[model samples]
Every structure is written in C-alpha cells, then in structure tokens.
Target: MQLPTTDIAIQTDRLTRSFGSNVAVRELNLTVRSGEIFGLLGPNGAGKTTTIKMLTTMLPPSSGAATVAGHSILCDSIGVRKRIGYVSQMISADGALTGFENLLLFARIYNVPRRKRTQRIDETLAFMGLTEARDKLVCTYSGGMIRRLEIALSMLHRPEVLFLDEPTIGLDPAARLQVWKRLKELLETFGTTILLTTHDMEEAEELCDRIAIMKEGVIAAEGSAEELKQRAGTESMNQVFIHFAGEFSDSKPNFRDINRARRTAKRLG
Candidate 1:
C-alpha cells in the first residue's frame, strides 16, 4: 500500500533481516512522520542497528519492504540515499582536517554546487555552533564538538531525513544537552525528519516525539514517552524499558559495545 503523502518520511512493511538462523529483525513495521524526531530504543543485540542498516540502504532485507523519503528501499535505493543523511555511531570527520575543511570535503562529496559550497559550509558551521572552531583541526575538538561537526557534515546537502545512530554516545551530560539543543533547532529550522537509535532513556524521552522499543527482533512497545509511562505504569522511561524488554543496563551502551555488536553481526552474515 502507498503511504498517504509527503507527511510520511519513512515506512516499513514486515521488514525482516536474518543472520543464518538468527533473526536480527523480524516483520518490523514502522512509520515516521515528516519533521518529527522519532527514536528507536533497544538494548544490545535487540536489532536497532540492523533496522537502521536496512532503512539507510547499507544492508538489504532478507524479506519484506521499506520506503524512505518517498522512495522504495528495494527499487529506488539511490533515490532513497540521495534524500537522506546518515550519521553512524562512529565519527566520520577526518581528525587531520579542520572543522571547516571537513564540511567542505563533504559538501563536495554530496555534490553541493560550487558557488554554494562556501556559503553552505559557513551556514552549517554557524548553525552547529562550530564557527568559532571552524579552522581548528578535528583532533583538537572535544567529543561534543566532534559530534556537532559530524552532524553539520550530514546536513550540508539538506537531506529531507536524517538517521543518527547513537549521536550523543560518550559525551558528558552538558555535551549531550548541547547536542539535543542543536537537534531541536535543526528540526525547527529545516523541518528535517530525524530517526535516531539510542540506549539513553533520558535522551529518548527528552528529544523524541515518539519512540519504539525493540526486543528480541520485534517491537515490544511504541508510543510517546508519556504514553509509554502510562502503559508501563511507571514514572520513567527507564522503567518503561525494563517493563517491556525485561532488561536493564544502568549505563547506556557505549561505542565499544556498538562496535562489538557490528563485528558479531558481520561474522554471522
């Protein structure tokens, strides 16, 4: 069935992925509205990353179908790619390059017009609060600064949808807040639909318009934070997660866990 209109940024119908006998994602159906901040919350090995890979066209589904930014993932993969930006768990900025240089490089890679490149880079830097450090080498940046720069690079081409896999991982509380602030601004300024995967319950509660909790390759629950709390008969997202997934981690998974999961998934593949 066709999605209603431009109001839908992403839609999936019975999307599934398997690694040998292990089903990483199974019959996953989801929809994200335009200009909304949608969160995918799950613990380690819960298939959040696998879902993202499928939507971003980094991996083909074992069965089923999906559409991103009005293009079919199966039939119009390039069209889907061109309309969306993905910021992976791993930072993509070059440490040797200055912040501005990194933006310039991506602008070129994204085929930003020659005449518009400099202006777009400056605008994105200022928007990301990186203008002051625009010429500083990325290696000199703080974790928060690097995250903002990575996000800036992703936005240079003005994609209709942005996928962020653990965008604030490894940052302190203050840095995480700053990133959240910028993300809200991005939505207001550009109306870009954001799909994010995060283990941080607080982050999801604060930033997401809606959230879907995944467990054992299926969606266990989905709703706004308040709705989830009501459903779980709890006062917090943490409790909500525990109620649905029957698991809890005091500390959210970090980059190490993310990498380890990827490696394991690759081995299975």
Candidate 2:
C-alpha cells in the first residue's frame, strides 16, 4: 500500500530488493517530510545502502515503488535525478585537482548554466568554508575538507532533497563536528530535506530530526532521538541502536567498503 503523504519529500511503498536468494531490503514503507533531517540507522548489510541506491535510481528495486522529489524512481529516474542530490560515503573529489577545479567540474556535470557556474562554485566554496583552500589540490586536504567538498559538489545543482550514505564515516570528532555544522547550515540555507544513513549514533542523534532503525531488512523502530530513547528507556542512542539493530553482521560489502571501492571506480571511470 502507498504510504500516506503530507508535505512529503520522499516516500517509498513496499520497496524491496534482492540478490538471488538473498533479500537485501524487504517491503520498506517510509515517508520523509519536507525540510527535515531523517536518519536511517542500521547495522552493516542491513539494507541501508541498498535502499539508498534504489531510491536514488542507482539500483532498481525487485518490487514495489518509490518517489523522490515527486518523480518515480522506476519510470522517471531522470526526473528524480534532476531534483535530488546524493553524496555517497565515497570521496568524489578528484585529489589530483584543486578544490575550485573540482567544483567547476561538478558544476559542468550538473549542467549548471555557464553564466552561473563560476558564481555558484564560489558561493558554494565559501558556504562550505573551502574558499581559502579552493586553489589547493584536494590530495592535500584533510578528511573533513574532502568530505565537505563532496557535499559541496552534490549541492552545486541546488537539489531539493539530499541523500547521504555515511557522509561522515571516518572523521575525527572535530572534523565530524565541522561537517555537522555545515550540514545544518545547508538545511537552513536551502531548506533541503536530507535523508542519511550512518552507523554513528552520535551523528544520528546530533543531525537527525527523526531516525529509523533497520534490522534484517525491515524497519524495527523509528522516532525522534528522545522519543526513541524513551521507548528504549535509555538516554544513549548507542543503546537504542543495540536494542533495535542487534549484533547482526553480514558478508556483503559494507558501506565503508563501497566508499573505498567508489574512490577506485572514480579513478577508473
């Protein structure tokens, strides 16, 4: 059945995906409203990335349907792609290129008008605090700087909904905080609705207005951080994750693996 929609930014109905005998995501029904940060929390191989791939039109679902930014993933994938931005865990910035060069490249890729590309890139660079480093090669940037650049690249087209898969996987606390700050600013500046997957409970608690915990390919629980904590009877988001997600692990290549793989794929692409 279709999920009820009210001021919705994203909605999925019975969305399922499988690999032969394995069912990665099973009949997911979800709704994310406009202008809110929604977190998708799950253990490794719990279908977080799979769901993202399907929703973002990177992978087709085995059954069911989804709409992103009012465009169907299956029938109007291109339309969906045009209205949303996605930043995977992978580092998308070209280390061999300067930060400015990277944004210029992405601007062209996003088909930003030639008349607006330079101004847009500059504004984005300043917004992400990368103006000073714009001329520097991305190879020399810190992990946080690289992450910020990736986010900036995704935002060059000014998407209405941004999907982030493990956006802050391997950063120091300070770097993570910086990324968190920029994300909040992005939400306020663009009113972009964000849906992100992360293993970090602190990141989820800090950035998400609401969170959904998935276990074994289905949503086990969902709510605001405090509401979930109340349901789990704990103050710790970690404990809440444990209670909902359990210790399940899988052999499927996890998001971190995909992050590194995509870096290599970009080199080969």
Candidate 3:
C-alpha cells in the first residue's frame, strides 16, 4: 500500500535578521514537513527566537523570505497567521482574568464561532488538565498551571501549524513529561505541524523528529538527534551542540536567559 505525500508546512530561504549593528540570524535555510515536529536548537544570541519570529510573521526579516502553510510571510502575513498558532514561552493572559475567561476571549479573537466557542474552550481546558483551574485568576495559578493554560489557548483555533517557543521552559521534569505527552497526542490527532525552539538536548531528542542547530546566525548542523550525534562522533545531543557551537565561544548567548525571554514574550503573544 502507498500513502500520499504531504507538502512542506514551512520553508525558508536565505532568511536573515539584524538589529542595526548586530546580525541576529543570517542566510539560514530550512524546511519542515507537514505533521512533523521540527526543533531549532541554539543558545542565547544564536538567533533561534529571531528565526521563529520571522517565520511566524511576528517580525519582518531584514532580508530573505519564508512561507508557512503556503502563505509567504513577506507577502501575506495575515493569511499566514490565519493558519498557524503561536505559543510563546511566557504565559499569555491578563492577571485579572480567570483561566476560563482568558480562553473565551482568545477563542473570540481567533474567530471560533460564537456557538461552538464555549464547548471548544471547555474541551481544550480539559485536554490541558486546566479544567479544575478554569475559574481561578491567572495571577493565582502556579507556573506549570499557567504554562498549560497558555498551550490550551494556542490550540483553541485548531491551527494547522503550531509554533512553540520553549513551550515547557518553566516546568519541572514531571510537568515537562506531561506536556510532551499532550503534544504527541495533539500531533497525532490533529496532524499539526509543530516547530519549537529549545537548547535542551533531552527535550530535542525526545520531542523532535529533526533538529536544526544554529550558531552565529547560520545553521551549524542539522539532522535527527542520533544522526547529528553520530556526525559529531559524540554520544549525546549535548556533545553535538557543543561541537558545532564551537569551543571557547563566549560570544554565544546564554540559553537560560533566552528561555526567560521566551516566557516574557508569551505575555505579548
């Protein structure tokens, strides 16, 4: 038996970004297939977030271009946004709004029909294990709870592609595992194309079908976790990252700080 081939969900060519004096990302080329999990692995100042922002149509690239689900980010940002959901690292909610309230508001913003919005909100909350905390103010929710709620909000629109920027940044090990489990189910059930940025080797190895390792605004290396490790003659993904990112690279950005930025952006997402 033969199955039909799926088209690429994401494609970028010579993608570049700069902040006046500093080039954040440069000449980066990549592609992500439909229904697959693609991971971007990079340390701080390595341009992972910048690439994500450009691809998601949040930030315009300084040069080059990309397409998400067939809409060119440079030409049809609105069309691109319509087909994708972005879950930033920071929780996106008004502190005063309860979990249920925030979800409802986003549903309306995403244009989920008025009639189906309520049921959709309830279902998403339950799926994220946020149903019990639905009515509690976001200010009162713990870090993990808030993270889960943010994910639920991103899924409300049932987007064909989901961009998760360090989606489990603040979670504990157990909570992170739970998140991965939920994400796997979402990919299988909805055929969602997921693109996430992370420096965590274990997270990349477990959740990503393929990974692109970025350094100094370019792709240093890319492949499956095992393939990269083998190419580097290393025993683990961490070793592979270290090899490609280079030795004595103080110029590289801090991943921990980058993770914090991810959390902060969620509020803006």
> Candidate 2: where are CA atoms >4 Å away?
1-6, 248-269
Quote each prediction's TM-score: 0.92, 0.92, 0.91
Q: What tens digits encode model 2's per-residue C-alpha lDDT throughout 1-269? A: 44445478999999999999999899999999889999999887788889999999999999999999888999999999998999986667899999999999988888999999989999999999999998999998888888899999998999999999888777778888999999999999999999999888889999999999988799999999999999999999999998888755543656666667557444323
Every model: Cα RMSD to truth: 4.7, 3.4, 3.6
lDDT of 1: 0.89
Model 1 / residue 187 / CA error / Å: 0.4
Q: Give the Å shift of residue 115 in candidate 2.
A: 0.8
Q: Enumerate residue pairs that collide in model 2.
A: none
- In the range 24-121, model 3's lDDT, one tens digit per residue, is 89988888999999999876778888888998888999999888988999999999999998987655777899999999999989999999998999
Higher-ranked by lDDT: 2 or 3: 2
Give the clashing residue pairs of candidate 3, or none: 44-253, 90-263
Instruction: For candidate 3, give the lDDT of residue 198.
Output: 79
lDDT of each: 0.89, 0.89, 0.85
